[model samples]
Structures are given as structure tokens and as C-alpha cells.
Target: MSKVVLITGASSGIGKSIAVFLVQKGYKVYGTSRSPKNIENYPFELIALNVLEIATIEKAIDFIIAKEGKLDVLVNNAGMGITGPVEDTPTVEMKAVFNTNFFGAIDVMKMVLPQMRKQKSGFIINVTSIAAYMGLPYRGLYSASKGALELVTEATSMEVKKFGIQVVAIAPGDFATNIAAGRYHTPVFENSAYKENYQLNLDVMDAHVDSGMHPDEMAKAVYSIINVTKPKIHYKVGDFMQKFSIVLKRVLPDRVYEKLLMNHYKM
Candidate 1:
């Protein structure tokens, strides 16, 4: 039987790309959107879901189980981005991003893990970002949320490794997607001194995303991770320089790395 796969936030961006690519490659793919009326007519099945809502998450999982009989893979690709100076970002706004990006992903993993444990085999890949590892100006909240997911993936993998369930985090750099449209810019940042720099940073990020790597590359990475007998705990997918930057951060002095990051973003 073809492997059964479920991906959240599959309405657009990288999530949508993964769903389409997987289905073409013959995986039984189910993609999700929060609203029933807002989904595109995709080749794979669609499930309505709101990652922040536990009930909806459970329902989506149950629906998959009932239809597929078993779940083999889950890609927690559902997430939102918030951009602004952290100082001006409201507590509520920060929480809102975490609710969707981190907590919501955790809920899906918690819901799916039980069945994965029972079957003694499954793969859970959380779609994180390169920003999770680096400190990006104006995108601090987005970075922190994904960073939280990365740690969870690492810790959870250690716990579930004995059960034959693999948990992995795939951190992608900027990709050509519609993520910018959905990103929340902190409203409170308007009066801050950092406003000018914040706008410049936002503009830079937008340009990078507009001309970034294709989502198809991410789909291929996901496909490979699923097929592996022993998948890695983390996979960094993107430009060589972005991937190399992670290494540079590790080997370079803290002082030097900080300067490089500032220079890279023109901060």
C-alpha cells in the first residue's frame, strides 16, 4: 500500500507544494486548511482543520484514521509568521503566533503519536525555518516559535526512538511562497525608533522570499525523509550558504558571529 500522509497548512505555500508533490509521487496525501470554503481544488484530499483548536486537530486525526485505516507520516507544516521589533510586539500578538506555530504543531504531534506508538512505526516531520537557528531582526517572534518547535522535535525524538516512531524537524530557508501575505506585522511597532529599520528588514525578507528556493525542493526533501529507514532528527533544506551559516555560527566566535548576522541582514 502507498504510505498515508497528512500535512497541515496545505492550502498554500510549502504545505501545498508538499501535498501536490507527494500525491504525484503516489503517496495517499491529505492536506488541510482551517476553513472549509477557503481550500483550493487540489489533487489530494482536503481536511478542514485549525491547528490552534485541539478539537479540530483530534477530529482531523480521527478522520484520517477512519479513512486510511492507519497513519504512516505526518508533516506539521501549519504555521504563521509574525514580524516586528520584539520590544514593540504585544504579548497577545506573540502568543497568537506561538498558538499557531508552536502549540498547534505540538497538539497534532500529541494526537498522532499514540497511533504511531501502537503501530511501532511512523514519521513526524515538523516544518521549521532557518530563522529558527539564526537571530533575524524584525522576525524575532517567527524565529522563536520555530525554534521552540525544533527543540520539541529533538526532545521528542529521543523519547519516541524506542517506539519505532521518528520525529524530525525540517528547517527551510526563504522559499517562493505566499507566506508574506499571511504574516502578521506588529501593530504596536509604529511609534518605535526601530520602525525604519524594521521596515527595511521586512522589505529585505520579502524580497528574499519572493526570489527564494522553489517549494518543490522542500517536497523532495520531505519525500526522502519519509522513505529513509532511519530518518535524521533534523534536516536543513535551502541554499548552501544558509545551511553553511549554521555551521559558521557553531565554529565562529560569538562576537564574530553576531557581527556577521548583523551584516547579513544589514541591521
Candidate 2:
């Protein structure tokens, strides 16, 4: 019997790539998106879903359960990025980021766990980012959101291990995806706090992401993990610099690591 996999944020980038790859591997892939029509003629079924919408999330899951009878894998890949100084970022904007990136994943997990428990087998992969481990200049909000997700995945993995469900996080370094272009930026008050460093931080973050790794690589990494018999709790995927960044942070002193990042961003 073919395994059924559900992936959120399937309209583009890594999600789209994974959906296509899984379909090719003979999995029954149900890819969810806010606008399924925009991704017409895809290999898998595209279900309309907006992760922030509770009703839509429930409906989408129910639809899949009715059609497939079992959900073997759930990839929580939907998220947004907010780039600006943390102090200057609006509370509303920060909430929006968490709503989609953190709470959205948690909601989906809660909805799917009952089914997975009954089935006695399933995998939940949360697509986090390298930012989860390291803070960037203007990406504090985005980083914090992903950081929260990392902790969630850590605990969820242990909680569900006895039930034969695997929960893992994939932290991909800078990926050349719509996320960078799709990032929301709000104006900071020139006279407000952190003004002196706000624009500088924003520019640095923009340049770094613009030159990040390609999304297809991240998709490939996701595909690899889904097949593992005992997948690691977390997998880091990115270019040399990203991998190095992780290592440097561990070995170097806090101030030294900060200096390296500052130099890398030319701040």
C-alpha cells in the first residue's frame, strides 16, 4: 500500500519540490496551500489550507483522512519571515509570525496525533531554519519563532516515541526560496528606539538571505529524512558557511562568534 503524506505550504519552493519528489516516489501526496488553483496540474492533490485558519486546518485534515484513510506523514512547512530590529518590530507583526510558524504547526500536530496514535506509525517533520540556532541582525522575530518550534519538536519527539510516531526538525540554512522575497518589513520610527541600528541590520539580513542555498536542496534533505528508520531529532542542511556557522558557534566564545557574524554581515 502506498503511504499517504500531507505537506503544508505546498504552493512553492521547498514544499512544492518535496510534493513532486514524493509523488514520483509513489507516495500518495496531498499538498496543502492557501490557493491550490495557482498550482494547477501538479502531480499530487492540492488541498486549500491556510495554517492560520483553524477551520481550514481541520477541514483539510478531515478531507485527507476521509480520502486516504491514514496519514503516514505530516510536514509542517508553512511559515513566514519578518525582517527588522526586534525592538522596532510591531507586536502585531511578531504575533503574526508566531501564529503561522509556531502555533500553526502546533495546531496541526494536535489534530493529527490522534490518528497517528491509532495507526501506530507516523512521522511529523517541522521545517525550521538555521536561524533557530543563531540570531541574525534584523531576523530576531523570525529566529525566535523557529527557535520556539525547535523546542516543540524536541519535546514532541520524546512524547510520541512510545506510540511509534517520529517527530523531527529540519533546520535548513539560507535557502534561495520565496521566503526571502516574501518577508514582511514594517517601517520603524526614525526617532524611535533602536533607530540608529535598524536599517543597517535590515540591509545585512537581506543580503545574506539573497545569497543563500537553493530550496531544492532542502527538499532533497526532507525526502531523505522521511525514509530513515530512526531519524535524528534534528538535521541541519545548508551551504558550507551555514554548516560552519553552526560549528563556530559551538567552539568559539560568544563574543568571538558574534564578531564573526558581524564581519560576515559587514555590520
Candidate 3:
């Protein structure tokens, strides 16, 4: 039987791209949106699942299990982005982003694990960000949320490996997606100390996404990871420099790396 796959946040962007690609590859794909309705022309089915809502998560997982008998893979890709100076960004907003990007993904995994455990075979792919490897100016909260998920991915992999469930994280650099529209942007208050710098980085961030790699590249990476016999705990998909930044963080002096990031963002 073809693999049964469920991808969260699949209405558009990277999630949608992965869903479409997997469908073409002959997997039974079920993509999700918070409100899936009246959408069409897709080979895979779209279900209702909001990572922030436990009921929706449970419903979606149960629906897939009831129909497919067993879910073979889950792409935990439903996440929101936030960008603002850490001090100026509302504490509540930071918590909300973490709730979605971090706790929300964990909730979905928790709901899906029992079923996978019973089957003794499954793959869980947590969609993270290359930004997770290092904190970036104006995008610190976004980085922290995804970074937290990356750690959880590692711990979960070791915890579940004995049960035949494979868990891994795939961190992608900027990709051409509608993520910018969904992100919560703290306004560039005229009087705020970070106003000018924040505005500059906002433009920089948008430009990066506008010119970033196509989502198809990430889809292909996910497909490859799915087919591997023993996938690594973490994988990154991005341009040479984006991926290399992680390595630089490891080898470069703390202040040196800080200077590089500051210069990159023109801080």
C-alpha cells in the first residue's frame, strides 16, 4: 500500500507544495488548513486542523486513521512567524507564537503517537527553520520557537526510536511562500529606538522570502527523507550560505558571528 501521509498547514506555501508533490509520487496525502472548505483541483484531500486547537488536531488524526487504517507519516508544518525587536514585541505575542510553532506541533505529535506506536512504524517530520540554529536580530522570537522545536525533535527521536517511529527535523531557509502575510509584524513605531533598524530588516526579510528558493526544493527533500532507511536527526535545505551559517556559528568566535549577523541585517 502507498504511504499514508498527513501534512499540517497545507492550504498553501511549503505545506501545500509538499502535499502536492507527495500526491504525484503516489502517496495517499491529506493536507490540512484551519478551515478547509471549497478548495479544489488537488490530488490529495484537505482536512481541517489547527495546530492551536487540540480538538481539531485530534479530529484530523482520527479521521485519517479511520480511513487509512494506519498513518505512515506526519509532516508537522503548521507554523506562524513573528518579527520584531525582542523588547518591543509584546510578551503575549511572543507566547502566542511559541504556542503555535512549538507547543502546537508538540500537541499534534502527541495525538498521533499512540496510533503510530500501535503500528510500530511511522515517520514524523518537524518543519523547522534555518534561523533556528542562531538568533537573528528582529526575528529572535521566531528563531527561538523553531529552535525549541528542533531540540524537541532530537529528544523525541531518541525516545521513540525503540518503537520503530522515526522523528526528525528539516530546517529550511527562506522559501518563496506566503509566510510573510501570515506573520505578525510589530509596527515600526516612530518613537521606538528600533524603528529605523526594524523597518530596514523588515524589508530585508521580505526580500529574502520573495527571492528565496522555491518550495519544491523542500518538498523534494522531504520525499528523500521519507524514503531513506535511517534518516539523520536533523536536515537543512537552503542555499550554500544559509546552510553554511550554521557551520560558521559552530566554528566562529561568539563576537565574530554576532558581528556577521549584525552586518548582514545592517544593524
Candidate 4:
């Protein structure tokens, strides 16, 4: 029997690339997006899903189960980016970011795990970001959200190990995706206390993202993890910058690392 995999946020970017690659490699891939209208004639199934919507998530999962009869993998890839200072970002926007990035992913995992436990086998890959490790100038919310995801993946991996289900997280750094373009830039402050500094930080992040690696690299890493016999709990894939950032986070003092990151963004 062919293995089945469900990927969210598949309309474009890394999720779409993974879906195409996995389908070509002969997995029964189910690619999901908030709307399926724009994506057509794909090698595998395309389902409509908004991770924040419980009905949509349930419907998409039911569709997959009815069609495939077994769920072998779940890729919690649907997420959005919110960039701004922690204190300056609106509470609503922060909640929205967590809704899609952290809680949304958790919802999918919660729904899928029961089925995987029944089958006694499955893999869940949470697509995280290197921002989980390093906090950038205007990306406090984004970084915090991903940091939460990393912790979730780690804890869940251990929890599910006894159930024959594997959970893993992929933290890719600076992928060339629409996230950088589509990012919601919240006001750094309502009082305009740091407008000039905030704008400079945004510009710095914009340039860094513009020069990031292509999304296909991340897709390839996803494929590799899915095929592995014993997948890692966390995989960090990206350029030298990403590795350096993670290393710094591990070895440097919090204040020292903050200075380094601040200097990187010229803030």
C-alpha cells in the first residue's frame, strides 16, 4: 500500500513544493490550503482547509481518511508571519499569529494523533523557523510563536514515541517564500516612540529574506525526513547564517546575543 501524507498551507511556497515532490515520489499526497480553487490538476489530492477553523480541519481530515483509509503522515505546515516589536504589536495580531502558527498546528496534530495511535504508526512534521532560536529586531512575535512550536514538537515527540508515532520539527532559516512579502507589519508603537528604529529593523529583515535560500531546499529536507527510518526530533536546515545563529543562541549570554542580533539589524 502506498503511504499517505497530508500537508497544510499547500497553496504555495514550501508546502506546495513538498506536495509536488512527494507526489512525484509516489506518496498519496493530500495538499491543503485555505482555498483549493486556485490550485488545480495536481498529481495528488487538494483539499480546502483553514487550520484555524475546526470544521474545515475536521472535514479535510475526514476526506483524507475516507479516501486513503489510512493516515501515515501529517505535515503541520500552515502558518503566517507577524513582524514587529513585542511590546508594540497589537494583542489581537499576536493572538492571530499564534492562532495560525501554534494552536492551529496543535489542533491538526491532536486530530491526527488518535488515528495514528490506532494504526500504531505515523509521522508528524512541524515546520518551524530558525527564528525559534534567535530573536530578531522586529520579529519578536514571530520568533516567540516558533519558539513555542519547537517546544511543542519536542515534548510531543517524546509523548508519542511509545505509540509508534514519530514527531519532528524542521526549522529552516530564511527561505525564499511569500512569507517575507506577505508578512503583516504591525505598528511598532502607537505613540511613535520608536518609529525610525522600527522602520530600519524592518528594512534589515526585508533584505535578509530577499537573499535567503530557495524554498525547494526546505522541500527537499522535508522529503528526506519523511523517508528516514529513524527521523530526528529536530532538523535545522539552512545557510551558514542559520547555523551561526543557532550556535550563538547556545553559547552566548542572553544580553550578548541580543547585542549581536541588534547590531546585525543595525538597531
Q: Please write out the lDDT profile of model 4 over residues 174-259, one tens digit for every residue.
A: 87777776788886564777788888877777787788888888888988998899988889989997778898888989999889
Which residues of candidate 4, in runs, are more than 4 Å off? 188-191
Q: Which ranges in model 1 have alpha carbons more than 4 Å from their true place?
A: 38-40, 188-190
Cα error of candidate 4 at position 96, Å: 0.6
Return the lDDT, model 1, position 267. Answer: 70
Give TM per candidate: 0.96, 0.94, 0.99, 0.95
Q: Which candidate tops TM-score?
A: 3
Candidate that beats the other on lDDT, 2 or 3, i.e. the better one:
3
Model number with the top lDDT: 3
State the weakest 10-residue window (summed lDDT) of model 3.
Answer: 35-44
lDDT tens digits by residue: candidate 3, 94-180: 999999999999999999999999999999999999999999999999999999999999999999999999999999999999999
Instruction: State the lDDT of candidate 2 residue by residue for 1-267, as single tens digits.
Output: 999999999988889888998888889999998878855579888999898888998999999999889999999999998977777778999999999999999999998999999999999999999889988777888889999999999999999999999999999887666676777886767786766566777666667678877777877888889999989998999888778788888999999999988786556
For TM-score, candidate 3 versus 4, the one ahead is: 3
Ranking by TM-score: 3, 1, 4, 2
What local distance difference test score does each model get? 0.90, 0.88, 0.95, 0.87
